[model samples]
Structure formats: structure tokens, C-alpha cells
Target: MATPDAPPTPATHPSADDVPIDKSTPDAEPPPELPENARARRYVILSFWLVVVLLGLPLWWKTTSIYRAPLPLRDMQSWADGRACRAEFPLLVEVEAPELSDPEHLIKSAQHALDDANDFSAHHLRLRLASPKLTDSTGNNAEENVAATLKLLPGPARSSHSYQLSNVSREIELFYSPSYNPSSSASSASLSLFVANTLQEIFAEEQQMISHLLSTSTPAPSSASGDSTSGSSKVNHAEIARKMSRILRYSPTYHLTFSLFTGSGTPTSWEIEDAIDEYLQPLLGALSGISNFTIDSQIQFYASPSDNVVPEWQPDGEPAEGEPQRGKWVLKKQDLSSFINSAEWPLASITSYPTINFIIYVPADELTPLSISGSATNAFLLPQWGGVKILNLPVEKIDGERKTHLTREDLKSSLDTFAGQLMSLLGAPAHPSSLPIRLDSLTRQRSAELLTSASSTLGSLYRLTLALPSISIPTSVSTAVSSTLESLQNACQELKQGRVGGEGGALAEGRNAAAQAERAFFEKSMVGQVYFPEEHKVAVYLPLMGPVGVPLVMSAVKELANFIKGWKASRVAKA
Candidate 1:
């Protein structure tokens, strides 16, 4: 027991050096990646890139690309330059001489004289014997195609050769002497010469207008003598230009607004409907063949003139002896221009067509008889807009109250002035004393104007397309341009055939062309695309492309680096 105790006290722990070692094999290095596995990984990355290139990229491009319709730029330019079509007007005049046994000779002689006297061949008149049915019992032209009816009547023995134009119809009465004979060569020559001279005088203004239009627009056709400027010296180009500037652009419809504006609360109502019906209906009926019109009326209270309309005091015909120095307010000529308070006036209409406003402004009692200096009239035209009249109405006292109202009689003069202004604004010629003839001239003028305008618009559109290559052109615009070109060609053909006015004529077709050209030029899609620049496209695409492109580029670079490393190692081993 003592020996065991001594051994236990001497016992000691084993040191790390004396510990026993059971050595197990260290973990083997991961097995070298198989060649097949490495190849499979590279192929996987390549498949992803192929999907992105073949499918994703093409899809994005297809979604973002703009659709542009092709256009015929060259054809458009040719039309604009007046190379595609040549416009000409050949008028036909009918001569009615029922009393003459041989009207054919008279017609032949007159035509010869007309041809010799005509300097502008494009607007030459051809004389033909009028058919019996062309004139009505009242001696007016029943055929719309006939410009005028020449009624030949035998004059009294004492009467001389004379002609009178009817104010109510398109008839020219030629009073030939009873001694005149169509079979006699000398008499025929004299009568033919007279007729030719009269016709020339009647159409002189129209010829000048048409010549001016041709000279100002496309190259004019040469005269019979091969001179284009033969009669250029006779044209008043400045006056024609001024008158054209005042006329409104052609439209299918027009809205006329008659407004009565008073400086005070009086004159709350007016018989404008009756006045228009009586004074304006006749003129409107005459112009119905050209354009349609819609009428409206209104009354406004407390409408004052512009601040520039300051009036000066003038004595009223030397005040009666001690009549408290009677005086009247007079507006100067300069003030007439600023008499309209457009800012406060409700001049705008809701119709889509153009609006022609006629205002009747009644002055206050304190400023009655507001007359323009150096002029007896108080009405003035506003040129392409409308007319204005200063109505100095006398206030009537009834039952201790003021009665201010406009009757049809009080507005007669103003309405007459408005009618005249309307004609001037509509480009009616002021000669020949024949309404139908004047309207015909206006029709030709408007047709020429609209044709030129449409051509100019087409040219501008073509230039715009060239200037802004990035702007998108829609299919609608292409269709509109084609329609416009077709209409222009039709109009030119109609003009060449001498169909100047009326529905389905040159004027109507020209208007259609102009409208279509405007629509094409102002297409909303094209205009919207104009502001979207290449920079904007870049800004829009960069964010989407950045994330997708970065990974693809990095993967490609890594794969390339690995491939180069393997190639170098294999080369060195082979060496």
C-alpha cells in the first residue's frame, strides 16, 4: 500500500513532444477541372451572348425604329417650279345678231379684229354666233357658260352706234343704225371694228389683272408676236398688289357678324336682321356661286373707342348769337385707324371658316357727330377684316325717358356702304358696270392666286424635308401630298379648258389643292417629330443599353484573357 501511494505522488502529465502521432493522409488537392467542364462553361457564356445578339438586340431595334413613308420629292419640286403644268385661259364670247342674214361673216370679221388687237394670247376671246336658246325673253343670258349676251337692236334713223350694259343682267345692248348692213364689205368691217374695240375696252381691266398675275407668279406665256412683255407697261402693278393685299384668301365659306356697339347703355337693340335681308341679301345671292355665307348679329353696351381716338372741339357753324358757345367733337384722320377697340370686342366667331365683322359703333350724347376730318362719311373698310361705321343717332325723349333703338331705315346708308366694302374685299373689279363680268374676273384672279399659293406651299414642304432629315414623315402626309398634286393637275387642266369658276371648276380644284397642301405641311406627327433631336434619342437609349452592355463586354474580355493564357502555356510546353 505504501509503495502504491509513493508511485501515485510521483506521477506526471505527458509533454506534447512525448504524445503519440497517428498520421492520416492530408486532404488531397481538388482534382484538376476536367477539360470538358471548362469547355462547357465557355459555351454557356457564348450561348447567352448569341441570344442577346440574335434576338434581344433585334427586338429592341424593331420596337424603337420610326416609320417613314417615301415621297416623290422631284415631282413635287417640278410642280412647284411650274414645270409640270402650263395654265392658260381662253374665253369664248357669243355674238347675237338675229337681224343679220349673214352672222357668220360678222363673227369671222369680229374674231379677226379681236385676234389682231389682242396682245395677250392666253386670255384671247373667240366670237361665235349665239344660239337662239342662249338668251331669255328678257334679253338676259340664260346659259351659265355664256359670259355676256350681246343683244343687237336696230337703232332709229337719227341714232348713232352705241352700246349700253345692263345693270340688272349680263346683257350688252348694241344699238346699230338701220342703215348698217352685214353683207356690205365696208359696213361689215366698220361694225366688226366697233365690236372689237368695245369688247377690248370691256375686258381691258381683266386682261391687265390676269397678265399681272401671270407675270408675278409663273413665267407668263408669250403673246402672239412672241413677246411676253408687250403690254407690261400698261399694268399698274403697285395698285394691283395693294388691292390683292386687301382681299382675303379664298375659302369655301365665310361668316359675317353684324355687331352694334354703344358707348352708353342706350340702343340696346337693333333691327339688324331686316337690314341685312334688305340690303345684303341681293349681293350675297349674286356671290352664292363663289362662296357660301352665314350671318349673325349681336348688341353690346358700354363699348368705348380706343384711347388714341381723341377728338378736337370745332364750332358748330358759328354758334348762334350767345348760344353758350356751341361746339362739336371731331375725330381726325389719324384717329380713324385706332377707332376700333379690338381687345374688348368679341369679334371672334366659333365657325371654322373665316369671319368678316361689320361693327356699328354709336357714340355717346356728349360726343355726337364724330366725323372723320376731311371726309363726309363715317364708315371705313378694314381690308380683309370688315367695315366699321360711326352712327350718330339722335336720342329721342319719350314719356320722360330716352328711347334709343335702330330701325331698318336708320341703317340703310350704313348697310349700303357695307355692301360696297364687301365687294371690294372680295376682289371685284370696279369697271364694266356688269356684276356678272366682275364676278367672273374675280373667279379667275382667285384661281390663279390659289394655284400659286399651293405651289409655294409644296415647295416649302420639300425644302423642309431636305433641311430636317431626322424628322419623321407619316403615311398620312404622303397621301395628302399625292392628293394635292392630283388636284393641282386637275385644276391646271380645268383652267386650260377655260373653266374658271363655279363648282368642280379650276377655282374649286385649286382650293382643294391648297387645303391638302396645308394639311400635309402641317401634319401633327411630322411637327411633333421635328423637336425630337438625335441628342434626345441618345439620352433615351443610353440608360437601357448601359446595364446590358457592361456584363457582355466584361465576360468577353475575361474569356479572351483566359484563352490567351492557355495558348501561351501550351506553346511553351510544345517548345
Candidate 2:
């Protein structure tokens, strides 16, 4: 009984105090940390956050922020809106009448008549007397300041009054009857009126073109009386559109490609260099003031016409006795547009300048004497492209075999046609019969065109910047824009001063402005930021920042909550 009682003495569960504690083992929970240590831990975390906020954030921003240069947005917008510059063409016409004792009277009368007749104020024609010394020697104008020279001479007795414009120069000669006296007021008034009318006729097309350009570029205010000749009344919109469609856009330079496409390999080479020198050099020289030209030539053998140019077979008119029957090929006018086989031909431009292709296609012997239906000449013009001449070479017997080659003489007519087409494609006016006057008109037109083009580009760029706020604009773009604005200002000044053409003139300045504007608008760096937007950057950084930011944010929140609780507790105790 005593042994059983001793066995039952041990309890199943022992009390916490009854358990034996090991000195090597630590307690289940450590003692509460000292306030100094807790404060130190908070101080360390706060310091880390302060480093990230003050130093790390700024460093990251400095390294990653886009560099955007300040642009002259207002000035650009002003230029685009046509408020900055108003183009004016002040033409100077020189009077050279060596026979007249007092030229000033005639000039005054003519100027009065001109002022009264002219409806377009933007094109002011100022008349000035030529220097006696300069005109007395050669009767030629030595100065390039005048747009044209008006030459007055007394004709033979009983001869009728007539006027003729020099084809090679800017001189317009007026031959009056010997009976007509310059001293008589009636005769002087009549002569002055005639001169004014002639001048107006010479510049009518130019005024129309300028008016059209102004109206199209910026809507001009309509006159209350609607008597303004500068309105659409004078402009033939359909004709202008057709002409403009045929003309290539204004450029400082153009590349000319003269290609000879042959169905057979007989005509492998041609005297193109000589032909160009003789027929095209003069035109090119005259246009040098407006633009430069680069010319090249190539010959493609075994080249055939496109499918659109299906030729219809027609028997040759009454074949000679004992001669084999011959046939001719005819091309339809409707199919001329697709005659150029762009897919097979090498018509691609190699240079940066706009290319004008002049094609001379020669068919095989069987298809000789090819002609277009209902057309006199075998030539056609491609609007804004170039011209095509279907040259059919006569088959000649050489060493009892057929042979064909293009000589300078053979290419003369084609070259002449090409020259005329070139003038048309260059926006040259068909009036006055004076090459120099037409060239001057071209200069003014090109200047206006380039100025408007540059302004439009600047406007587009400004709009794009406003639309895309995140797009990066580099310093180069700002520099280009500044240069463009400066050049535009200079061009406007030149135009105002009547220096619209020639070296370092309004045209040149406008070209520079347009180039700079294009550079600014097409900056490659601008496209990069457009593709990589703010949302994309955030997405890229989310994985890395999530882990790091969560810990920092939670710690800050916990610390703030603890501070608020401690503050409340202290306030309660004090109350």
C-alpha cells in the first residue's frame, strides 16, 4: 500500500515554475527593447528614407529626365498664321529712250497710267530712267536690277506703230510713227497708255498666279465692292490647277534623266551629250537663277512598251510596186498615261533631287513609223513627271544589213519638244515671248511657294508638339527652328526689297528656311519618345520598385501610427 501511493505521487502535467530551466537556452521571448534602441532603429529607417528622397530620387531624375529645349512657339505660330511676314513684289522697270531729250516726262506719264491700271497692290511696278552713259554705248542694259527694259524708237515715215519683245533678252522695243511727237501731250498720253497696257498684259498671268497662291495658302479678305482684280475673277482655277498639276514642286535642284528605251539592241548608243549641249543648255542656263540641274542618261535595250500601250496595226499607205507590204503601229491617246513600264524599267531616282524623266522609245523595224492616234507629233507629256517621244528610226542598209543609231540631228526635234515641256513643268508663264521675263516670273512664284511651304511645316510641327506633350524635342530641333525663323525673316526682307531671285536672294533664303524646317520637323529623336510613353516606363519599373517600395511604405505607415497613438495617449493622461 505504501509503494502504490508513492507511484501515484508524480503529476501528469508540470507547472511552469516547476520546470527546470537550462542556462544555455534562451527565454521564449526576450525582454522589451530599450527606448534608446527603438529610437535608434527609427532614426536609421528615417535616415535611409531621407537619403532616398533627397539624394537618390534627384539623381535618378537627373539621369532619366528628357532634355527639352525651349522653342519659339509663339513666333512659329505667328509665321504659320501669316501674321509675321507679308510678301510683296516690287518690280523695277527701266525706261531706255535715248532719242528722247526729256525721259522723265514719259516715265512720269507711264507711271501714272500704270498706277491707275494696276489692281494688285502687292505687285508694284516702279519705272526708272536708264543711265544715259550705260545705254548710249551698246543699247543694252548692264544692270540686273531692272525686271525689264522698255526701248522706244522712232519708226520710218508713214510706218505704223508696233511693239516687239526680244526672245533672248528682257527688252521690249516700241516702234512709233515718225509723225508722232513725244513733246505733244496727246501723243505722250497715248504712248504712256500703250506702255501701261503692254506692261499689264505682260504681268497678268503672274498676278493671277500670285493671287491664287495667296488665296489658297491663307483665305484673303474679300473686298466689299468685289471690284478687286486680285480676286478669283481674274484667276482661271481649272486652268491653273491643270497647269499646276503639270508642274513639279519648287526645289533648289532637279535631276534630269534622259533614257532611250529600244525594242531591239540596234540603237545602243546616242549623241545625247551633244544634243543636250545644243538644245537644253540655254534653257538650263536661263533657269540657273531659279534652280540648278543635274543631268544623266542611260539606254535600255530589248525594252518593250507597257501592256496599256497596245498598238493597233495599220497598213502603210500603198506599198511601192515589187516592194513587200509594210504596216505601221498606232498608240491611243487614252493609253498614254500607263505607257511607262515602271515595274520593268529602271526609272528610280538615285539622287535626292526631284527627277524629271525624258524617255525616247524606239520600236523594232516591224513597228517602225509608230504614231499616236489623232496627234500630229509622236510625243506626249506626263504631268509632274516628264515627257515621252516615240522616235521611229528609219531602217538603213549598212553592209547589206540593217543598222540604226541616234545622231544629234535626229534628236534635235525631240530635244526642242523636251525644252518646251521643261518650261511648262517648271511653271513658266507662256506670255510676253521673253525668256528673261518668264524666268523672273518663275523666281517670284518659287519664292512664294517655298515661303508658304516652310510656314506650313512649322505650323505642323507646332501642332504636333501641342498634341503630344511627352514627345522629346532635342536641342538640335530648337536650333533648326531658330535657323528656319531667321532665314524666313531674311527671305521676307529680301522679297520686300524686290530681291526675289538671283544668288543669295529671297528664293535662296526660302530654300534654306524650308530645309531647316524639314530637319526640325523630322528629327529622329522625336519618334523614340513617342513610342516609349510614360505608361511604358512605369510598367518597366514596377517589378523592381514593388518589392523595395512596399517595405519602406509599410515601415513609414507603422511609425506614423505609433506616433499618433503615443500622442493620443499622452493627451488623454493630461486630460
Worst 10 residues of 2 by lDDT: 219-228
The candidate that wins on TM-score is 2
* RMSD (Å) per prediction: 6.1, 5.2
- List of clashing residue pairs for candidate 2: none
RMSD of 1: 6.1
lDDT of 2 by residue, 1-575 (tens): 36544445655798889998798996689886788987998998899899989998999899878777899999989888777876777888888887888879988999999888766666668988887665533344455456787888887789866788888777888886677777799988888888888888888888777767765764222211224424435588787877888989988899999999998887878999999999899899989988899999999998888877788888878899999878778888888988999989999987999999999998888788789888666899999999999888877767876556688999998998899889989998888688878988988888878888899899988888998877879999999999999999999889878887767799999999999999999999996666776788788889988998899999999989988988999999999
Q: Can you list the residue pairs that collide in candidate 1?
A: none
lDDT of each: 0.81, 0.83
TM-score list, all predictions: 0.84, 0.86
TM accuracy, model 1:
0.84
Clashes per model (N, Cα, C within 3 A)? 0, 0
Per-residue lDDT, model 1, residue 558, is: 95
Q: Candidate 1's error at 121, in angstroms?
A: 3.4
Estimate the lDDT of model 1.
0.81
Q: What does the lDDT read for residue 541 in candidate 2?
A: 86
